[model samples]
Target: MKVEGIAAIVTGGASGLGLATAQALAGAGAKVALVDLNEQGAKAAAEPLGGIGIGCDVSDAASAEAAVARAAEAHGPARILINCAGVATPGRIVGKNGPLDLSVYSRVIAINLIGTFNMMRLVAAAAQSLDPLDGGERGVIVSTASVAAYEGQVGQAAYASSKAGIVGLTLPAAREFAPVGIRVCAIAPGIFETPMLLGLPQDVQDSLGRSVPFPSRLGKPEEYADLVMSIIRNPMLNGETIRLDGAIRMQPR
Candidate 1:
């Protein structure tokens, strides 16, 4: 669908992949909303884009509802939804401290998996009521997954499970939304130069980058955003998870 003048919502839009996508969408004339847990950061990010920022906990039903309502109040019902809010707190089932805390696993699942569904359902409900655009398209949703979902390493039980759930949700969501002219797809990115990864020592970061098979470097946020734009433009790209990894299959460490 044409992004110009359409309303769009991007969770975790204060930083990383979500931020990049918000910028891209806004640049393309979409009325973007930056929804994030960081109120100040969200506002700061939105200001330059001429978009509104809302503080929202995507995992919570009420919080997500309020956020969607606020976005509708400001920009109307969204025709684009990007789910990028997630946590990658890695841990083993049985760590040095014995079995990992159940809360840790639950937390990851809530934010990464459930949060995705929460936002998707709310946005889809709004999209359903809207009139279809060209080719009977009403809206598009792009979610973030990870290479770990397919090949989880030793210490990524919770993270992998959560992402795998996202992968599992893609096809069913697409099939369900198809009739309403809403498309659902996901991007499974390899290691990227996100803030979390940048926080590590430079040497460690370099080592990780070198692990990629070719072009041998971490992905840029803009690259991910480009894919989002592509998907939005190409209506046929639905119900699929595209891996943005640089031909790298992570090995067990």
Candidate 2:
């Protein structure tokens, strides 16, 4: 689907990858809606980008539906939905401290996997009501996964499983939405210079960057945004998970 003159919703748009993507879409002429848990931050982020900021918890069904409806009211039936809202909780299923806390795992899955699906279902429903755009495409949805989905290191059981669920969701979602001219795809990112990674100590961050095969540095948020823009532009791409890693296959840490 074309980005120009279309309405778009970006979950987790307050900061990090989602913020970058919202800016990209707005730059490409899409009317963007920024959704995040941080309402003030979302508003601040969207102010200069010429987009609306909405407070949303993608894990909650009611909150997500209301948000999408609010976006539709402002921008008229979004044709682009980007799922960048997620959380990463590092924990072992069975650690040296005996069994890991089950709540930690549940929360991770709820925010990362279920949240992605929650937004997808709502956006796809909204897209289904709209007529197709060029190439019989009504909309395109791009979700964020992680390289951990493929090679989860130690203390990454929760995080990895959540991302792996996102990977697993792509194809079937694409198949279901095909008739409605909506495409589903995912991007499994490697270590990127987002707030999440920045929260780590400098040495830890450096070691993480060095793990990449090439470019030997953290990925820029704009780089991830670029791939998302490309995915929206190309109609032929669907039902697949693209790795945005810099040829990085993480080792078991």
Please name the candidate that would achieve the greatest TM-score relative to the true structure: 1
Residue lDDT tens for model 1, 74-135: 99999999999999998999989899999999999999999999999999999999999999
Write the residue-wise lDDT of candidate 2 on 1-253 in tens digits: 6788999999999999999999999999999999999999999999998889999999999999999999999999988999999888777789889899899998999999999999999999988989877789998999999999999999999999999999999999999999989999999999999998999999999988888888998999999999999999989999999999999988888
Q: Model 1 off-target regions past 4 Å?
A: none
Q: Which ten residues in a row have the lowest lDDT in candidate 2?
A: 87-96
Candidate 2: misplaced stretches above 4 Å?
none
Error at 202, model 2, angstroms: 2.8
Model 1 has a clash total of: 0
**Alpha-carbon local distance difference test for all models:** 0.96, 0.94
Error at 122, model 1, angstroms: 0.2
| TM-score for each predicted model, relative to the true structure | 0.99, 0.98
RMSD of 1: 0.6
Give the clashing residue pairs of candidate 2, or none: none
